[model samples]
Target: MAGTSKPAVYKYSRGAQPGTAARTGDWRFLTPNWIYRPSPCRIACPLGSEIPAWLEAVKRERFDEAWRILRRSNPFPAISGAVCFHPCTENCNRGQLDESIAIPELERAVGEWRQKHYRPPAGPPVTRGRVAVIGSGPAGLSCAYYLNRAGIGVTVFERAPVCGGLLALGIPQYRLPRALLSRELEMLKDDGIIFETGVAAGGELPLDRLNEEYDLLFLAVGAQKERPLNIPGAEAAGVISAYEFLRRVNLGETVRLVEPVIVVGGGNAAVDAARVALLQEGITRVSLVYRRTRKEMPATADEVDAAEKEGVQLYFNLSPQALRLEEERPAEILFEQTETAEGKIKVLPAPPRSFACGTLIYALGQQPDWEALGRLSRELTLFAGGDLVSGPSTVPAAIQAGRLAAAGIMERLKRRPGTGEAQFLEGKPVVGFEELNLAALPSAHLTRRLSDPVAEAGRCIGCGTCSSCGLCALYCPDLAVQWRRERYDVNLDYCKGCGLCARECPARALVMKGGWEDAC
Candidate 1:
């Protein structure tokens, strides 16, 4: 009787019964997870640029689409490509293979190419509201761009004769061309963005009046107030702030200086000032002093390298204590030896040393003029960003802050907001160097091109995303893996949960988990 007992059989149907599926583990089967993890370069960007997406588009020879995608996050790609510190390149995964893609140069090339064919998009049809923006710096301009594109009229007021605040007067021509800056600003102007140059927001147009006139207000006055060295002899004849020096030089003013000029601080401004000092007629040498070592300096590595190449003597682990003046003119400076210990500044007991120099240019830092905002009246919806809110930062950071402010304003205006995030993965398992299966990738595709952007994009690791390399299906020992409709599917009838597919995944996008099934 026991040997003759009937064998039970179950037929699967797409019905409501949970335990009546063809495969015993239909609902509780192990799934091969595929996700697009955030690339390190994209994560490093302040503007949240979809770096990999554009890079892929470039690889496919979709230049216009790539340009459009790039512009979605960054408005001034050409300007940014020229001046950005490019932290993205530093975080590039391709560097592990051979050399990091020349992201900045590629961006510059594509950006300039797009600039030749750029046309301002048609303004939004519905008139939602009007807004007032103070300052025409990167932050203000970016804020106005977003607002104007959203069918909101933006009136930008700049105190300078030209619209670009720092881009026009702070950055030198050799680094950022004025013609290029002017041309990019023209795009914003053509978009119906009102630019009122030579008009100070809190001066010609009072804050109270602006509040009453516009429904919303954004203040991005920037850190125009240069922080000065709090030491004696700073008021000497040749002792001047770096901002004033750079501004005057950038405005085409003739600046004549004596030999051996000293520029204090290690930030970007300090490096720029030192380089500018070397260009003066009588300046034979430029000396730059910083409290920290070269590793801890805040300026970009390329800037420091360029300054060194341009004959700027760098003195690190030295802090300026005082300036010495001879007959009311800068002649020497005093410095204190310092070191960073346990993340704290430690000034040693060594005696202060003196160095001889004709002029002193101090660029310690800059502070925003918060008082310029006046009282925050409850009657007005006020917002601020860039250096005004976050202190001194980079141009891309300012642009990102401006975008955030625009979204906040749009929400207040009862309008829908745009997706400010990049098209990348989040919270996925990060593939490490050891986890990568590089043998599946061809060695020829690993070496990228320097001059070719499309070729350069091929070197990307495509972290946490399937590259469809066929390694998973090809290496499946059980013959359970099947490729159908551009995706891999595992036949549970033959699969033994061996996890060979997950191990052989080049992108590390697949993972095997514990699974359960109801056996009838």
Candidate 2:
């Protein structure tokens, strides 16, 4: 062809062009970045609460609005803010850059505002379906909160004279104050959750009576049984179990263990037990013995550090061999040093080493007492202990048992004498916030805010659920997150239980099981 000018060229005004006098296009749009990105903290939450949105409100000093948004998912933000084991902190992208934001503290600050202005929601009508929660621990309380919010009457039966099972009994005062516990209880009571303190459920209350009366029953009994130290002189005096020690402290008992205390185990309880033992000035030497190395220590890093800080000496790669009771003097806590091979620590090897201490605290672990559940033993046998055993192997496992039991009951109801149209309808998430334009989101990366160790109240020693981020309410795109006077509720129908909320969740709350699998 003639005068084709080598197929000519055209250049555009925006991006890379034809190299001639042509127009370029959207160079900025070509930059590949989400216009609106969700905060990692919000995305990691279980409730799927609008993290960035609420934070944006807070950044603008909209205290009222911030609380309003927060309360939509977590009714107990103030309590949870102060106590939730903030899992979101671990997942905060900012942590890689610097310290994550003091999310729990921020939550507490917002919760403080909410506490001042927040009003519990009043219900329209009460349903005949009554839910009886066995123990007044977090799981029980949480279940009660949601059940009550769903308009079901709830009754919490606790064997202890007081409420807040772990919150009241297991946790140290420095961490969870009694007043906060009472206030949270008051909040629940205001929402119509009944508490039968000092009433034993499996014994005096009886599940049969509950089943006969209520539409359904939920058992949230936590494992309180401390692992037994079956060794020579095991029945001797001055030996305290973790459960006993925590219970005594929680119930305000004055126990004085002699100096040279040897606590066994590397878990949080072991640390807590050792530290608490130090409160007894007579207890001078507090050493922890674990068969594992420092890396394998199951206790939270903070707890292990705190134990060391508080003068609780730890001897890793060691296990208690036996307890030698001198009848009156300091008991001997015999231990054997351990070794590792092929990445696994070798315990009870041929000829082991041993150490001696005064008072021996077997913090090996705890188990759940399944004797109470014996009535249903033949029928609905739920293992609190691992492997369908009658008892739970640990306190946390017991709590898990309670939750499983409750979930099972809920699932049974869903299958049997089923949910109404409104019941299933209510399970759907509520829509609130508008869709975010990911393309317009912040150009800056996740802003990590280092958490101040100084909790206005105290430090959280790994207990309970609900990570401080309250992410469950934040990341929920459907806005299904809501809170009633009693507690938090996530509408499952609308939730799809995508578990994006779960996987991203810092604290393993807002659990999702058996879902579409690709929603995340």
Candidate 3:
């Protein structure tokens, strides 16, 4: 014991000592900053919905708050939830781990919740500006909703007897239920948005009257002019465009279909037409012929799968040459076998083959009828969006266009010169899976339409969003991270520029920047 120098006693400083008293933040070239970057799902979403925020609310069982947050950007969540391709799910960071968080299902749950519990708000008085929206498609309705919410007097003119253009006339009831669409439209009406049905913009109501009557005009006349089937006998009595066919079917018109129905093209409309034909009475066989293979199909994989499941036969790499007609109706169709090479379709050298066809529906696509808009004077303030501007796009893209047009109109009304585009996430960096701390997250697989929405929502790791999990504070070796004023704050006086907090952050909300100056 005498020689052992009994355990050297080291006095502990109560607070900072010598070197620790100095601002350690100044000692390093890099600093940790809290910043919000667009998640890959948010970036890929055309409507730009704040998905993580609403998902957080959903997981917490705050359904009302989630619905409110969702409706801020998207007006018709119910409709979009059912019909949107849900590109957000495909780009979800969680998918890199195990499975995507079933975004569309959660979105639909939120939407359906709103539909069940929705109460009409007191109509906001029309106090700002007057806007005339031509067409009642997603774009037109979205523009009208935003404008009305801004206290602008908005009137939607629809050529169809019903208000919803594509929703009512293009998409079948199986995808977007008519009852849901009607309820959503009723809610919009109760909020004081006016809808005038059976009024054609360029036909009955002239563009000149709209320009003179309203402060601004928003045109969302969706792409309605079908691209014709240029083949011989395309004008046969049994041959029809897919748009016309779907429109007639959706409008409750009696559709008489013959057996061995053939639908040409590789898009959603083509698939819809074939499926609809299969459902018709007296129709046993419905075949879909596409010039390209299934991999090259523009239709969503789910729809294609559903078509196959519903007994619609699919024939790929067949290009229709001509329809052989009997009594001015399609009897047999001749096709040229083809192959895709370097993104181009090359006809095979084999002899042309023919298939018996009782009817032919061509879903080649549609174009915007711009004849009336061409006559309007450029002097008038006109904002055009949706399929009218970008032909044959998805519902969410059309909604985005409408939102942008509304913003532009609002700017013009406020006498400010600006493009109508939403600039919030323009320059923000999109967060990738590599930037996330996946090690901190547990692996889980969420199925679509899971009975427990909360459980499904809980799977989301809140990529690129701060959840204030206190991991930063917990992992900081220097005790420099502090939770203050509802957010995490770093005490630069004690922070030594260590990257531990950033590395421990599960949300990728904290990043180490190159300079001591805050880059957030």
Candidate 4:
């Protein structure tokens, strides 16, 4: 009878009773199996800032704690919150549902809130160490902040007429307010970070001397030199470098330009300069000329859109070939129309010409003068992109580089030695983000906050780099998300290589490994 007993055949209809979509194994404890330890968003950030912790503080209105958490990665949250271009938002799990969370706004809120309410305790009088920083840009100011916090005195020297080398002069005020800049500088001063404005740290001021005086020296002199407009007779009276132009305008230069201005190049500088020129000339016909199409233009989309909306004309597929001079005065601007060839835009010979009344502002771009930097280029270090020659150029990138530089300096001092291990970077697999149980995370239906479409112009200038669609946080009925935060701090911890978070993020912001596709 046992042998004859019919082997039961359970039919699995498309919906035949599914086994309780079994609780994904708990790996956080790492008992029977390994648990993923990383917070997805933090993993996405370049600096690995404890995002979840600070964001949790922001959510709970613990502004001071949040500010402190942000300070751990970026000491200049106020500066970054304003202009750093929120890459975190691009990776936000909420972006899939609607728009991404207004991370910059949240950051700005916490930053401003902290600025108003909290204050760092002042350290005792300057002790043994002094860090001489060449510039007061984000890199320099940030380095000074960290060193000063560590009880090491920092003296920042700035060649610029003002304190912020790029932050004060290059960035437009509408984006990053001067008031906010001044406030952050004040905070640094209170924290024992000294700034010597108008002092050049180059040969005149002596870089060698700084190396001799301070225990450490950080060169952050930003790329100040501008690329000359290389058109015929570009040195004609009307041509000007975009850097000096923007700097002057931001510094309250009541600059009055001749009517019908033509701005060469389609970068941030070009857009800002053209828009400002329009504001000064009052709709006197400003044109942004770029050889490449708008897609390839280096200006942030917001910048380009704002310029267009503000009535700046755009001339794509055009490059100025020659600037006609007559009687020692410019007569006309000749441009060669461009056409895409072999996946690259190239200017054609003998092309269309446009007549203009006056000035040409070239924003083609700028770079660090290697000759000017000389051996310091070896020290300050810059790439063709004007970022530090090494590491990522973004805010988080600078954070990562600064941290590594600190480690290198520490090693040189024989404080902590490197392991001599080769850091060969190879991508590996991790958790299932979106595959989690959705019932746990309190109303997964609720969406993340975002910039209002109507108010997009005045606010919402984003760097556009997110993908976060939250499933892992919502699933794991055992409250795994909270546990992850508690154990490894979901802030910026590395994962236990589980696929849960990867499965849960609908945005596919995370990926996993070991041949476990979505099967896990």
TM-score of 3: 0.87
* lDDT for position 288 in model 2: 79
Q: Is candidate 3 or candidate 4 better by TM-score?
A: 3
Best by lDDT: 3
Q: What TM-score does structure 4 among the candidates reach?
A: 0.75
* lDDT of candidate 3 over 1-520, digit per residue (tens): 6685788788786665566666666666678898877888888899988888788788878899888778767877788889999999999988878788788888888988988998877645565678989899999999888887777889999989998999999998899999999988998888888899998876787767887888888989899988999999998788889999999999999877776899999999999888888878888799999999999999999999999999999999999998889988889999999999988999999888898999899999889977856766676678999999999999999988888888889888883422232335768888888878866654234444478888888887778876555678888988888877656888887878888989988889888988767634
- How many clashes in each candidate? 0, 50, 0, 38
lDDT of 1 by residue, 65-138 (tens): 76777867787777888888898888776677667767776676667777788787774543459898988999
Which is the better candidate, 2 or 3, if ranked by TM-score?
3
Number of colliding residue pairs in model 2: 50
**Which is superior by lDDT, 2 or 3?**
3
Ranked candidates (TM-score, high to low): 3, 1, 4, 2
Q: Least lDDT summed over 10 consecutive residues: which range in candidate 2?
A: 26-35
Model 4 agreement with the true structure over 98-156: per-residue lDDT tens digits: 45556677777767876787576754766646667777777777666666655566788
The candidates, ranked best first by lDDT, are: 3, 1, 4, 2
Off by over 4 Å in 3: 1-32, 372-379, 415-423, 442-449, 468-470, 473-499, 512-520
- Model 1 clash pairs are none
